[model samples]
Target: MRRFASRGGIDTERGAPMSKTEDESGTNAQERGDGSSQSSVAAGRAFGKAVLRDARRGAALGAGALQRGGRLLWSRLAAKTTKSERRASPARSPAPRGPESGAPASPPFGRRRLRRLMGAALLSLPVIIALSAAMAHILLPNLEEMGARAEDRQVFEDAHGAPLIIRGAVPSAYAPLDTFPRHLVDAVIAIEDRRFFQHGGIDIEAIARALLRNIRSGGIAEGGSTLTQQLVKISYLAPERSLSRKLHEAILTRQLERRDSKEQILEAYLNSVYLGSGATGVPAAARIYFDSAPEDVTLAQSAALAAMIQAPSVVNPLADLEALRARGALVLDAMEAQGRIDADEAGQARDEMAALVPRPPAIRYGTWFSDWITRSAETLAPAPRGVSLLRTTLEPDLQVAAERIIEQHLAAAGSGAQAALVALRPDGAVAAMVGGRDYGESQFNRAVDALRQPGSTFKTIVYLAALAEGFEPGDRILDRQLDIDGYTPVNFDGRYRGEVTMLDAFAASLNAATVNMAMTVGLDRIAQTARTLGIDTELRQTPALALGASEIPLIEMTEAYGAIATGRIPFEAFGIRSASGMAGQDRIALNPVPGASGPQIDRIMAARQDMATLLRRVIDDGTGRRAALTQPAAGKTGTTQESRDALFIGWSGDLITGVWIGNDDNTPMDGVTGGGLPAQIWSEFMIVGLNLADATTVGGAKSLETTPAPAQCNVTACRRAYRSFDVSDCTFQPYSGPRKLCTR
Candidate 1:
């Protein structure tokens, strides 16, 4: 009944009719070529020509031109066809719907095209899926596991190549990854890495959630880090909480994924992560927590340890056993949710954990050597890829003796004094090292880490330098009051011996004489000699360095002296001898490497002879006389300023040892001199360490300058028996050398 033009100017009603002028269809008279119609047709043809011309003009322009051109072209085409078609076609019912009607007409392609498309899709469904899966496998795969970094422990053996123990923060044996119980692996994976098998190291979903949480909290509030990232964090990076560290972890994890197989990564992560109770890695945790190995662990036990991976200290069995078990139950539930284990198995595991009570680990055998070995392994050998087998230079019995000596002597010395010792072969193989009196009391390694002044023992290096400078031990040097550059040095007695042969001065450890010697031989040269001899610790080139003012490490000091005792070819102070994987596949030989070329053998021997006299005098009648052993050994005693540090460094042909005794608090020790306790310890160690005959022939540096005791006579046996200061001494007058006789 009503009709109207809508927004688009289209008639809204179906039955609407237009006036004859609006219809645009020609009037019947015009079609019949009436005079008026003929004029209209000519006008229409002109209009068509004008539209065509406009379209051509528009087509020459850009984007706007294209739109205009298309619109003009369509309009022109429609004008030509609209009237002709309306008159020629039969009448048809109009569409029932309009713009107002929600039921719009079907797409022009309509139901037929849709049906064909559906049929094609149905027919090729399998093929499409197959190709998609193939592409996914080439790229992402179905959570295929890449390899993980292997956390291998270092194994240390005794001198005879027998395994002493595994040396690492964690002390545990290697167990094959695949052999680990399925439940154990499952529990670990469920708690530590739920999508372990699903993700390619980085989890975008978890990261997004973590980022959101972090933004909400205005700080790092959550970690979406995967197990692989955790491995990289603990192994190569510090545990600092930072965005950069997280980024590094993410990158390292991706690399690990690309380099390792999935099973390998999981195994490595499981083995290396710190679990709890002073343990590092899984095997260690197993031993420390359950007193069992990884493979032997039950399902409940596995879950219990797995729970600690997130907050080891919080769920620590040592601190909170119940919490540990409770967390373990949660792991089982997670597994059940993932259908990794049945509900029945989860319930059974829960019961098992409830019934079990783990005991606190009773740690045993805390030795400084073990601690040192643990740290040394970082450089001596690569972490074991499978199982580490290390051969060390340790003499087990000697190590025991060193430990016992420290303990026994420290107790006897009394008064909170601490002692450290280091013993090595002439070639620089460390045989025995004691870092402190008791490792249980403290883990500080005094032998290598401490930097106490060497006192007079430093004179050994000074004397060595002097020998290099063409000064003979028997050559006389003035020890009278001398001042150099506003600094004055005195003997231990605070008095100067006017003039003594270099031999006697060194033997007596006269501070003034030693400083004079150091001055005679350039301070720089002395420092250089110390370094060249194997002392890697920094040294001062000042004159005070002569009197041992610059602090140094005992191990390095011993190492330096060991080079001399071995006749001056440079060698490193080393403990590791060789290493191999448990399977014996990757063997790494850690043999000694020469440091630098040294003095010729003849020169070293000659210098040794000169110092040999000096070393003998000290043990004979000088400061170190109290340290005299029945064997032939030479050493110097050192007493620091204010008796703060006392040291004795001595050697035979086979070994060199350094002993230090002092108050850890640096309080004076009842005027303890290096000759006292240090010398005594050195003597005691050598007695057990060397054969009696070998000891006698040890310090032959100056053997040519001294004659052997006459087997037939003392100064007495020649005429009548008489005694010298030495009860066992068979004294003859001083002899020049092997061919020269003693002159009275």
Candidate 2:
């Protein structure tokens, strides 16, 4: 024991040396000035001495082994050579030099070779380290902007510049730094980036593990990204799957760690992550999926989001059920392992999440109305992103009623026929729109896009222009076959009812009577009246334009009628009322600009009232009789040649509506007329639009004289006789003498 103690460099005191434990306790070791025992001091000294001794002994033994092995092989070769030489020259003998000459017979290979090999190994270490560091730094990309970009905000609004109520977006109060729950953070980290808290942005241990697994599995089943690295990858880097991109992501992640706190980085990461559908960020995702805030999410919902992160489309609840459940189960297992929930709770959460029903898809109601809304809103702000909320003058109840009426009428008309309806308020504010059967199927809004002839619905403008030309309702006009130059105009039935008053001719839509009136009233004056009523499209200068030869869209026609409804005060129709900047801070109020507002409703009121009186007469007893109602109303019915276009435009004290039914290809409808389906639609819509209001006329409407006057006139008779020279031999005034001779 004493010999062993001395060999170990231990003191041989009164008894045997202290034990290893006692020495470690520092009772037999050195002490510090602060009175704490330096227990590790002896162990450290022992470890260092032992290492040195082992190293020196290993060096000596290695040297001897190499020398001995070399000598043995060299002596054997020399022996074989000498044996061959002896066989050839047996008489020769070689002797060594004498000891007095200070030369040995053999050279030593022991220490010299050891020194050379050691020097070489020592020289190579620094070069290897330098090369490795250079490659690692050069191959990676720089991604310093990822976190900053993730923290930015996005906005959404409608065409009327109104803040849109996005279907699946969480509000601001549910953001990560505020209302987002801490468990969500844990679940994401646990499943996506374990060891996130311990790593310095890039997890080397995880990378090596992932590499080994991939090589063994022969596929990329795992991603070796820290959460910080993922944030850099998603926000700054393109989603290219390559080693070079991964290296760049790692390099940027390290840099990000140096610039931002872990919490700040995490906040940005969660906020920017997409949860699928149309949602772009976490708040948006939360709102879309749960219809709730982030903090309000249950464990099952959290698991659903976590599952979606693996493959958002494949596991989307809105997509596949079985796949989503299987994916969600994987997330639950991860959560359980992370101690976020117990195993039983995790399983229960997964089951519950699988059974949850997804929310409905978004609704895009008021298709045509939304288009007008967009246009009117565009006048205030050029784009939806620039404005906040737009307050519209829409009466929702009235708009709904109008849509319902049109929908019911079309349903009654049955399929294979499409219709578009537009309703406007007295002030020229569009209230409702129904473009087609489905907004999703076709966004091509017909109310504002389809251009068709106004048909006889345009006669009111011609009559009003005649009234303006000092032609009274009782003025003598002829309904005989007429001729103008080489064109002969015939009545709708191809037969003339000779000698009719202006009121009777307009009320019955008599083609010859209107032709004569167009000549007497001047076609230019009629076109001007149409323009003043808000028909902006060009009308032909010829008297043929007096009939409904011009084509107009529903929106333009509605605006024109809207002027007459408001007593001829032409106000430009607008959808948006106001706008604001981001977060509702910077507000810019918009009003109707000039030039869009045209003739005062009062100036044209008398003429419009006169025309309306005649039009109501038409609905009550003339061509538009099919559209006549028990209630007092003013309206016109129009049908194009070959029954191609049918129209009914009318207004009550409450609303003005236009209904058009025809083939989109301009093919004539099967037996359809202005008085048939279109009138039905107009009457139905007005009934609901007026909503039980008593039938009444505009209290101060101008009245046409209630009389029957001169039925035959010289000018009209002579014009018709010359106009029918080609199509008809019958003159305006029948001749008692013979054919082809005018008896005036």
Candidate 3:
């Protein structure tokens, strides 16, 4: 039997086994007290061990999950580390622990290190996302008022309300989306952006594809811009290639997509895209290329227009027909592939492209005049947006006549010679203008831009100044050779009259006599007189200036002559009569204000009458004798040295016309004088113009009969006999029968 002695009220077992009876008794005793306490202690130890094992497993799993998430975030946020970087790094090994040390083995990633890294990653994610969101928000663009950016039509009309030229955006050329044919829309989409409808503003798949292709090509040869992106760029961003710009474009694109529908976006894009040859939109391109409306355009024409999108100046039909045809074939093939058009349709489109002939150029009557008026209108009344109607003082018939006359006269002059003609009404309104022989040959507006020596035309200014200083038409001056300083001016014919009246010297265009008059009046006063008459060109105060050595624009000289014809100095020559737009009608002051005092007005009137008398003498029997008309006429002939410039400026009735003929290179013409070619052209034009005016009079022949004639004059019979004579200037014929007659 095993015996247990109790010490301090505890039972102790010395031997391994006890008797059956003793075992039974011990078991019962243990079950009652100490056995229960030992069991509870063992259970507590087991539970603590389970909890410890679970905590260790959880920590390992959490570390692995956090590491994976951090790696994914890094891959998304930054460029991936290359394989070369991995190869360059050395391999790490686990450190061996000493037997005496009690620390457990460290994980491949240290627990503390893992905790710090994961904690940082967890904390940075929200900040990074917030920053990205803020940046995207900041880069968003304003999409309000999309139509405001579109160009509006500008229509320029002549005095008769006839459209001289349509400039800027053509109203008829602007077509809405519904007006566009389905084939046109499909063609544009197939060539520009195939996934326009399917993608969000930023097409991720397209971007990836473009990226891969660019990488293989070793250059940025492809762009993944969707239609929305292109619209955003055209509307807001400049055409620049940069990551920052692309980012901004992408952000704006998304905003645009969210704000507008696909149809709206496509419409704006089609209407705003620039095509070649001054066409700005699909409708304009269609009209310019095909001479057809938007909806009437054939599929092949639509394809050609779409092809122009890549490089308008290079691929347009008018610029490069072969390139346009080739590109249009590609567009057709794309449309066929996308199932927008059948293969047979594509073939037909190809045939149409081969047969395509661009519309012949339209006959533009007053291009130079329209361009000048447009520029002036922009400066005077700028239309930010919407249609602008510019009513000008131009007469369509007169413009046509002027153009024809210039072409006819310049043909005989020579191939290298060019001509410019400007005609103004007595009130300083521009009636007709021809900047060059052909505007298509050169866009340089010689009438308003070219500064050439006015020759004797500027003598009018000197004489005008003399008259303002109380010199009369009969005021006599020596017309012999004269030298002032180092400048010596001689007459055009090299023969001078010893002494002559001011009117005779002027009509003969005696340079020496004109210079003497300029000297008497002072060059400064002459310059001031030129300014008062609307000659803005700089005039040298030399003696040569008196003989028209100063260079001046044809328009300015014409305007000065206009002032004399109207008896008004300091008046502006204006082409635009009225300009109305979305902003409002511009209050254009066409006529000069009556600001001159009584005495000043009287002086100007007297000078004007004297100048008129002098000019009439030149036309009647002097240098401009060839320019005389049956009715009262006045003018001056100007021939520069070596005949480099020849001009005839004259007035018949209420029309003031200035004609300039010269070589563009400033070379001399063979025996071409102002009295020869320019005067002939001027006479022919004036004859047609005055006849047309008379024929179109409100009451016809009856209107002429109403004019008050001398008491002995038979107005009707005299007009019938002399169709060209004004009733007031006619006299009764001596042998008058029952049917009274009159003569000039």
Candidate 4:
């Protein structure tokens, strides 16, 4: 009844009807504008919408190009389809019949047509032959290069930074080209890829057979990839389990065969193949599982490696020895079928391999030293980024000795107690570094890490400072309790021995006397003295520091003690000498510095001389006397307040050692003093390191120059006595002198 746009609707621009129905009705209404202009407007609107739709489609297509290209390239690269299968089907050929039986002799086609067909077939034969020759000469090399690049390779090294001790890898005996055990290779080809040699790379018949087997099994029970195709996949492609990936692998395999020699391709495949247990190559795998070289590997071993390649992680010898053996036997069967080995050889190899001794748990013997050396080597001569080997100076003997000493002593001390020891040469080169008893169980290197109070060991530095202050060892000093400006310091026993000589005070570790001496020289001077002697630890500016209140690591302590033994020169502790990359089958030295880093001229040399004398007195008469067994040794015993930390530092002129015994948690032990376990460990390691040499050969106090002393305190003693010159009064004074006195 009511329509908005009726037959008389008009266009504002053209003043015309918008539709045919409107145009006819518009004659009676209005026609003041151009009807052609209205048609143009509608056509332009349609064109704009089409342009927008096309732009949207173009954007989407551009976005998907990269992903689609990648997929296409991958498929082309794989190309697993066989040319024979892709060829025209013979079944599609016309059926043949007996001569003149059911079909006409020539089927109405003239001899001329037949002749033309024959001529076409005859002409194609030469072309096909020529094309094959061109492929053999041109395309083959390119394919081989692709396959070679696809194979995998691995590199590694030893603790000494020696070249890799490869597993499944063929040895130098088979070097230049991998020469597999003839039997092993034969068996693999027979069981796994029978047409391996005959085919350029991909095996069509094998692939067809595998496809049938897989379909029957309803799963991937058999792989269709030929050895070459597998090599192509392993070497050049991501190991994705997709049909496209397999297709690319087949193409690459064909390309590889055409380009490379059979021997070269096969060798690369064998060498690069994974054999489980983190072993990427056959040589590495052989050594890992059988502790044998690749050439020396038996058929069973070869079979094992071969089987491992199928599913390395599943057939890993380290994880499942039985499965590995079973897989290996299968490999052997392949080798036997391939005529690579005789039945007898295979059987014997199988039995011998099965009887191989299982690998033992890793030693992890020098875990602490290994880790420390590893870090040190990194700093000394850092490897390139992504490098795995680190050169180090870790002597097996030193490691063994340090470990045995730690194990024996810690076990003897029981589990509750902890100890640290560092043995170094006089030049500061570390011989053995034992952080704790079981470095393997605990990785903390207490030798270089833990900081504990030095106790009496700190006394040596105080005395050295005193010596630098012109104090003589033989000079007399009062060890009795005395007030220093009203601040009285007592001995360890809280009792003072009256009027003892300086040597006696030091020998007895007289705390009051040492404090008095330190005060006389000034605390700052003593701290500076310790610093010069290689003690970089923080020192408290208190009188207690005179008796080792400051804590230091055992390595620093030994190194300082070693400097003292060196008689004034500070030597940095180092293990590695130098390292160089391999050249001509030998490692060359990178640097020729004969010594570790330290002060050039020892500023604290004289102090070290005095320390030697004082420490010798400690072993001869004081707390460390027990440390001297068969030779004259010099050492200092240290125990902190409440006996929370115990330390003993000693040297036999050849080796300087320091030992610390305390709980890692810093909880005090029951009656475990430095003179107990620490001293014993020091003694044990020192004896082994020293070799019972004559002590005189090393720098001893006997070589030190004796100093003249002031007898001011001595003269004070005779001041109270009767003097002839001071006798002003002529009183006999009881004449209590020795017989024949001046009174007569």
Taking the tens digit of each residue's C-alpha lDDT, what string does model 4 give over 1-744?
111122224332332235654444355222535565455555644553354344334433543654565556445434533443366488874466557468655522333444465566556545544433322222122343443343312233332333222221212111223445765576556656778878777667877888999899999887766777767766687756643344445556655676678887776667666766656556556566666656776666666666777778887777787887777777777666766778888789778668744452233344555456656554543433221223334443554666788678778767466667777655455656777766535778888888888888888878877777778888777676667567676677888877777788887888888887788889987887666556777888887788787888878877777666765333457655444322222333332222212222223554456667788888888878767758767888888877888889988746778888888787878887777777887887776665534322322222212311111111222234435312222112335652211111
Best-to-worst order by lDDT is 3, 1, 2, 4
Candidate 2 lDDT over residue span 277-357, tens digit each: 756556566666666567877777777776777677666777876777777777788888878789788877877876865
Q: Write the per-residue lDDT of candidate 1 for residues 549-625, one digit (tens) a residue.
A: 88888887777666565554454577777788766777887755533221332344457666766787888888898
Worst 10 residues of 1 by lDDT: 139-148
lDDT of each: 0.68, 0.62, 0.72, 0.61
> Candidate 4, 712: how far from true, in Å?
41
Window of ten residues with lowest summed lDDT in model 2: 699-708
Between candidates 3 and 4, which one is better according to lDDT?
Answer: 3
Report the Cα lDDT for candidate 1. Answer: 0.68
- Candidates 3 and 4 compared: the better one by TM-score is 3
Clashes of 4: 30
Pairwise TM-score winner, candidates 1 and 4: 4
Residue-wise C-alpha lDDT for candidate 3, range 145-229, written one tens digit per residue: 3334533555566777554554422322345688899999999999889888888778888889889999999999778878888
lDDT of 1 at 189: 81
Which residue pairs clash in candidate 2? 141-248, 162-390, 168-288, 170-283, 482-723, 483-723, 567-601, 568-601, 569-601
Candidate closest to the true structure, highest TM-score: 3
